[model samples]
Structure formats: structure tokens, C-alpha cells
Target: MTIKDTAEEWEVRATETPFKGNKTSVRTDDVVMPGGSVARRDYQVHPGSVAVLALDDEDRVVVIRQYRHPVRHKLWEIPAGLLDIPGENPLHAAQRELYEEAHVKAEDWRVLTDVFTTPGGCDEAVRIFLARNLSEAEGQRFEVEDEEADMELARVSVDELVRGALAGDLHNNCLVVGVLSLVAARHGDGLDALRPAEAPWPARPFEV
Candidate 1:
């Protein structure tokens, strides 16, 4: 369908500054639906984000463990973050986050997939990247105030990563999807053979 025919037209009806100080902007709108029905909705359009599934020479994938306050738990995840400034593309953001969060830099980069984290409620989208040719670097650069990310970089077998996803051990959906897409793109039907048997994720935190 064409954009003009399928797109929903929206007009802002009113706005209210519910809170200030944080970098959040809440917007309320009233729109006329395609069937000539009127409806009101609220939206929070955040800046887009990027994530990386970095691989090393030994065929090990980089994974990180960090405390997530929202979930009130520490979880293993691929390196990722939101774009703080406007006009930053996913590749550049991915490269920056690799160094900022994991203290590593990649010499080569490839786009794995683009995902909408929650299209129904938010405008947040994340670009997943495959990073390789890694080298050690310095410390992380966190953006949020009172933010403390004690990151542990681990090298996990791709097979174990997939298995973790299947067993519901890995909680991040984007990370699972990104790694699987990269595996499929590289090995076609042979991806299953690249997985290590009885692989386990790193339980300790380490720098690059």
C-alpha cells in the first residue's frame, strides 16, 4: 500500500509538561482514524538505539553482564545503548557503545538486523550489528546520572547463546534475534555445526 493510503494522520490536540528535569517529553494527541473515527492517545517517542553481537578470532561472541534497575536484576546481554544525540546513525552508535560499555573496539562491522522493540507503545527502534576484529580498550562512558554499570565482558560460544535463548536463560529479545540472524547469514545450513556442546556462559566479570 502507498504511504498516503495507509498512513494514519495525527494532529496534536494538547500538551502538558507533567514533569521536568529528566530528558523525557510526554505528548498527547487526538487523531482522526481512517474510518472517520476520532481517538486520543499518548506517546513517548525516544531516540533510537543500537546493539552489537561482537565476535572474536576464536569464534567466541562477546556478551556482557550488567545490573538492570528496571528489572531489578543482573542479566547477561549484548552491548547496547540509546542514541543520546540526534542524527546519529546505528553503525556509529554501535561502534561508540562497543567502546563505552565494553571497553573494546572492533575493526570490522556489519549490520545484522533492525528491530522495533515495542511498536504498539513506543517509537524505540534498535539496530543490531555484528562486530569483529576486536582489541582491548579503556573504561566505559555512562550517560545517565547515578548510573553505575559494572560490566563483565565474556566470550560465549554461539551454540551456547542459541541454547540459552531456547531455554529462556537469555532475557533480551534483540540480542537473541541479532545473533541468530548473523549465524544464518554466515553459515546458511551449517550454522548448527558451529555451536559448542555443553557450552556455558561466563559467570565472572572481566574487562576486555
Candidate 2:
């Protein structure tokens, strides 16, 4: 049966944002679904985030080993950050994140892909960028806290990154998706086929 069928119809009633934080918000919605059944869905609302796939001259990718307290493991992830500033541009945020997290910058950038971090639980839309022509920010020091305080940066070949990701060696969603998107575009339609860094994001619900 299709979701449009009467058996799956639902209507939302009261919606409220009970908690608002710099990074997220707790939104609770009262609804009646599944043919008059009542339900309440509480979830986090995020302003969205950006992920950078920075490729150096040799085509190696920059990754970081940061501890994820939720998972209790030091996981590998690409340089990324959230869109928290009210007036900040997405491209500038991507550039800032790469520089801040990995101490690097890029001369070329494009929109590689976008992802819904988890639509079932949150409206956390994520944009992935493809960055090349990289340069190291001189004397760049990462000012991260908590689990990121002891982060270790590594540059690995794209081949290895792709293989490792495909073999389930890496766990970060952004890293896996970003790496695969770049690899495909590089060898398939070419990086020029990607959308501009300022491409419109229909899934981005927040203003900033």
C-alpha cells in the first residue's frame, strides 16, 4: 500500500520547541497517524552542517582521529562543522571548518553531495564539499575541546580511503559519502560536473 493511502494518513497537532541550544533544539510534535492513532514525536532540530573532502596535490585526503564519546571510540572523520552562525555563508563555513579542524585550506571548492543525517530522528541536513588545490595554514593550531582535544590528523590516499570505507573499516557517514562522491566524480563526469559551492539546498530548513 502507498503512504498516501488512508491507512497511513497522519496529522500533526501542537508543535513546540522546548529546548534551544547553539547546536540543536528539542522539538516535540503531537500527531494522529495510522488511521486516528495518536502519537507524539520528539526530535532534535539542527541548523545543518558541512563536511569537507580536502584533497592535496598528491590526491591524498585529510582525515582526523577524534574520540566520539557516544561511541566510545576514536573514529576517523573528514574536517567538518555545523552552521551555527546566523549570517555565515555555507562555503565560508566549509573553508573555516577545514582550516580550524585540520589546519588546511583549499583554492578550489564544489558541492559534492548533501545528506539527511537521519531524517527519521532529526532535520540535520549536511552538505559535503569537494576541495582541491590545498594549502596548509602556517602554524595552524587546532583549538578543539572535549573529545576533539586529542585529535590526530592523517592524510591517506583516496584509493585506500575508498577501499577502507567500502570494506567497513571507517564508520563516519560523512567520510564514507564524501570520499565516494569525489572518487566517482573524479573518474566519471569530472569535478567540473559538480554544482557550484553556492548551489541551492532545498533540504536546508534553517536560514543560516
Candidate 3:
């Protein structure tokens, strides 16, 4: 079907912010759907994020358990954080997050996958990276407090991670995508297509 589409296809009439949080904001858009019906589209506007899938010598992936108050579950997840900095590179952000959350630095870094967390109701996007050749970072000796205090990290085999994702046991979006992406890549080009460390992310929105 040769269907030509444009912003008019979305039929967005106007938009307004209802709640502006410290890191995110909620916006509602008045719009018309494809069938000429008017509607309201509400979504959270986010600045995006990065996640690191830390790999060890045994080919296991690092997983962390954290308490998510919203979901009310101490879900196991990969090391990840929001890209909240003004001009920090996403890879640098990922490296910092991996060290902060897991206290490990990787000598080899490659893009694993990029995903939109919840495109239907949120603008949150995350780029997951694969980091190998790991070692302890001396800068991670600081005392943990707040959310970091109760977090636990461990290494799980890549096969197990992929199994958990496929069996619907892994709920964390980044972990699921990262594990599957690595599995797929191993069966395919093996890192021949991994993006550079300084890959340009045009999808990351401009700061307000």
C-alpha cells in the first residue's frame, strides 16, 4: 500500500503539560486519529537512558536486584541509568552507571541494543551496551546510601538470562532486550555491526 503519511496523519491539534517532575513531565495532546475521530494522547516525556550488560570471564551477565516502588517488586535488572546530563556522551553515561551500580569497568564496549521502554505512554528510550573484559574499579569504594544501599549484584550465565527473558520471567526491558540481542548477534555477525562508542543518538531529545 503506497500510503503517504505526515504530521497531519497524526492530526495533533495541541499539547499541554500537566505535571512537571524533577526528571520527567506528563503531557496530554489533543489529536485526531486516522479515522477522523478526536482523542487525547497522554504520555510521559523523558530524556532517555542507557544500560550496560556487563560480561565476565565465565561469559555470565551481571544482574542487579533493586526495589522499584512503582512496581512494588525487587526486580532483577541490568545496570542502567537515565541520561540526565547536559552534554555527556551516552557511552560515558553507561560506563559511569555500570561502575556506580556494579563497581566494575569493562575494557571492551559495544552497543547491544536500543529500545523504547514504553512508547505507547512514555517517551523513555534506552540504549543497552555489551561490556566485557571486566575488572574492579577503585572509585567504587564509597559508602552506599538511599537506593544504592540495598541493591545486590550478581553474575548469571548468558544462557540463563536468555532463558529467563524467553520464559517471561524477566520483566526488565533492558535486560530482556540486551540478552536477546547478544544471543542474536552471536548467531549472526558477532559484533561486526556493533555501533561505535561515540555513536550519535539523534533520537535523544534536545534539553529544554
Candidate 4:
């Protein structure tokens, strides 16, 4: 079947419950079908987010191993966060997360891609960035005292990271997407040369 744009489209009829903790909203919308049928639909809109892919002098990607409360499991992920405040750009939020979560600062930064985490129901967007020329900095982690999480920094070959992601070893969507994009942009079609055969990690995750 061929889909055609109709002059009568969706319109927001009403909105209720402007705010909820997370993953919940109440909205009412109106739609006019091509056959002159009218219908109403409710929606839930979520917020946007940012993610960072940091690279150090040794060409090692900086990653954080943190226990995600929602997932109820410890997983390796890149530094990322939601835009808690209004009108905050994703790149600035990413820079803040990099320093807060990893305690590292980048001298050079570039936006790799912008993606929608889930488009069917929520209006969430994730902006990925590549950070280079990293240096030691102070961590500004989440202020929640009850949050159970400890961070460890690991340096792995780009190839190993990609393999781990495909194997479900690295499950964080933001990290996998951002790092892989950077790897592709850096190496083009010849990515095998950058993959590592084994894990090479530092004694701990701290300022270098």
C-alpha cells in the first residue's frame, strides 16, 4: 500500500500531567484520517540525553563500569546523562558527564551523531560525541547519596570493544553507538587493524 500525506493531520487536543518521575506522561491528540474519519490518541513524551566517547593519548577509549539501577546489573558504558534542565544542549551535557562520571576532560571535542533512543512512544534523543586529548580532572558524579555505583576506567582496543558489544558483553547502547561511529570515522573501511586481541587494562580507574 502506498501512503500519502493528507491535509488533515494530527493535532494536540489536550495535555494532562505535565510532569512525571520517568517514562510516564499523559497527553491527548486529535487525528483526521484521509477518509474524513476523526480519532483521538494519547501520548507520552520523554526527554533527551547525551553520550561521550573519550580517547586518551595512548589511543585507548575511556569507559566506565557502573551498576545501572534500572537494569539491576553492572555493565560497561560510556559517560552519559539526561538533560535535567530545559534548553540544555547535548554537547554541553556530554562534556559535563565526561568530567563528572569519568573525571577526565577533553581538549578536542566533536559531535559524531544524534539518535533517537525510542521513537515509537517517547521523544527522547541521544547525542553522541568524540572527545580527544584527554587530561585528568575532578569527578562530579550524581548527587544522589543512595545511588549504588562505583566507576572503573578501562582501556581496550577498538576492535575488542566492538566484539564485546556484539557479544552482549558491552550492553550500553550509547557507548557502543558512539565508539563504533568514532572507529568508523577514524579508520574508514579498514577497521580490523584497530582491534585488539586481548584486554589491556590499567590497575585502577583514576586520574592519569
Candidate 5:
């Protein structure tokens, strides 16, 4: 049997939206179980997201520190943002995020990995990209507000970030996943063997 995620939706007897937010909403579904029993599952419905792991010639990763109210901590993370529009091209979104968050642009791009953040609680799929050949973006930096207003930026080596992640110091989902995936790719067949940046993402389909 192939060890890959397959899409197969269980029978939904009923579904409802109890709460609706600006970008996401709470969804409750009465699903049929294996024993012919019905169960209610509530989860957040998100529009999906894209993240960029910008690697410089020095082998450092661009990172940002920002406040997350829900977690009540200033977590260090890579550049990431929501898809904004349904079926929006993830590569474009990732590039925009890298520029806006880190004022960086990349010449080489590849699909690092894709993941489901908090699958049990939210349907938020994130497509992480490996962005290399980095250079500062041209033009004024994007203005940030709220938690982002106090954001901090840094570039740390891949090894240090991996250390922090394993030491239980770094907790950002994107950063952890991105860095680890980067390490894995380097150790595996190699970065060149990784999927193309525009590779198909069944989790969040987008136009070329």
C-alpha cells in the first residue's frame, strides 16, 4: 500500500456554521462513524496559507519574531500569510509574504513541504517554500500594524534554528516545519530533487 494521504470524506449527516470570523469560521459536522454512530466534530475552516523559508548565500534563514495573542508569546517564525483569495497562486503569495515580512526576494524557489496545522482543531493547510538566491526587495517595506508593529527580524543559521526547535525553544509551526524539511531535503535526494515551486497542492489548489 502506498503511504500517502488520500482524500476520502466520511458521510456527513448534517453540518452547520456556529461562528463566522473575518478570515475563518467554526464548522460543526455530524458525521457517520464506523459503528453506524453519529458524532459531532467542530473545527475551524481556514482559507489556507503559504510560508517562505528564505535562505541566503551564507546558509542562514530569514526569521521574524511577532506576538501571537492566542499563544501569548512572541514566537519566531518564517514569513507566512493566508492565501487571501480562494485559488490564489501559492507561489505569488509566498513571494509577497517574503517581501512584506522580511524585505527579501528569491531567485530560486522550490516546494519545501506542505502541512495541516492543528488538523484536529482547524482545517488550515500551509504550503511552505524553499526560497534561495536571496536579495533585498526593492521599494519601501510593507507597513505592519498590531502585533506585527512590534515585530523583530533576524537571520540565523539552519543548525541554530534546528537546535532551538529541538530544545523546545522555538515553537512556530512554519519555522519548525520549514527548517526541518530543509534539513531533510539536503540529506535526502537533495534540494534539486524537491518538487517545483508550482507543484500541485491538492490541499489548496491554485492556478499557474
Candidate 6:
């Protein structure tokens, strides 16, 4: 049998949206379970997201530190952002995020990995991309406000990031996933064997 996740939906007897936010909503579904029992499951419905792990020639990864109110901590993370619209191209979103968050651009791109931030609680799928051949982005940097206005930018060696992650110092989901996935790809079949940047993402379909 293939050891891979398959898409299947259980029977939903009823569904409702108890809370609706600007970019997401709380969804409650009365689902039919085994033994003919019904259960209510509530989860956050998100528009999906894209993240960029920009690697420079010196093997440093571009990172940012921002205040996360929910977690009440300034977590270091790679460039990431929401899809912005249904069926938006993830590669484009990743490029935009890398530029806006780090003022950087990349000549090479590949699919590093994809993950579900909190599968048990939220339906937020994130596509992480591996970006190399980096350079400074042209034009004025994107303006920031709110928590983003206080964001700190830096480039740290991958070894240091791996050490920090293993030491339980880094907490951002994207950074952890991106860094580990990059390491895996490098040590596995190799980076060239990774998926193309425009590879299909069934979790978040998009146009070419």
C-alpha cells in the first residue's frame, strides 16, 4: 500500500459558520463518524499561504523577526504571506513576499515543501519555496505598519538556524519547515530532484 495522505471527506450532516473574520472564518461541521455516531468539529478556514526560504551564495537564509500577538513573542521567520485570493499562483505570491519582507529577489526557485500549520485546528496550508541566486530588489522597499513596522531583518547561516531550531529557540512554523526541508533536500536525492517552483499543489490549486 502507498504510504501517503489521500484526500477523502467524511459525511457532513450539517455545517455552519459561527464567526467570520476579515481573511478567515470559524467553521463548524456535524460529521458522521464510524459506528454511526455524529460529532461536531470546528476549525478555522484559511485562504492558504506561501513562504520563501531565500538562500544566498554564502549559504545564509534571509529571516525576519516580528511580533506575534497570539503567541506574545517576537519569532524569527522566513518571508511568508497569505495567497490573497482564491486560486492565486503560489509562486508569484512567494516572490512577492520575498521582495516585500526581505527586499530580495532570486533567480532560481523550487518547491521546498508544503505543510498544514495546524491540521487539527486550522485548514491553513502553506507552500514553502527554495530560492537561490539572490540579489537586492530594485526600487523602494515596501512600506510597513503595525507589527510589521517593527520587524527586524537579517541573514543567518543555515547551521546557526539549525542549531537554534534544535535548541528549541526558533518557533515559527515556516522557518522550521523550510530549513529542515532544505536540509533534507540537500542530503536526500539532491536539490535538483526537488519539484519545480510551478509544480501543482492540490491543497491550493492555481493557474499557470
Flag regions of model 3 displaced more than 4 Å.
1-11, 35-37, 140-142, 205-208
* Tens digit of per-residue lDDT, candidate 5, span 5-30: 88889999999999999999999999
> Who is ahead in TM-score, 4 or 6?
6
In order, the Cα lDDT scores of the candidates are 0.70, 0.86, 0.85, 0.67, 0.95, 0.95
TM-scores for every candidate against the unseen true structure: 0.75, 0.86, 0.88, 0.72, 0.98, 0.98
lDDT by residue for model 4 over 23-103, one digit each (tens)? 446555566656667676555665567788887777778887877788898888887887676665555677788877777
Q: What is the lDDT of candidate 1?
A: 0.70
Candidate 1 regions with alpha-carbon error over 4 angstroms: 1-21, 138-147, 187-208
> What C-alpha lDDT does candidate 4 achieve relative to the native structure?
0.67
What are the per-model numbers of colliding residue pairs?
Answer: 0, 0, 0, 1, 0, 0
- For residues 93-134, write the lDDT of model 1, one tens digit per residue: 778888877778887776666677766666676777778789
Which regions of candidate 5 deviate over 4 angstroms?
none
Per-residue alpha-carbon lDDT of candidate 6 for residues 1-208, written as tens digits (9 for 90 to 100): 7798878899999999999999999999999998889999999999999999999999999999999999899999999999997888999999999999999999999999989999999999999999999999999999999999999999999999999999999999899989988898899999889999999999999999
**Model 1 residue 178 distance off true place after TM-score fit, in angstroms:** 1.2
Off by over 4 Å in 2: 1-11, 18-22, 32-38, 139-142, 205-208
Using TM-score as the measure, name the better of candidate 2 and candidate 3.
3
Model 4: which ten-residue window has the lowest total lDDT? 197-206
Candidate 2, poorest ten consecutive residues by summed lDDT: 1-10
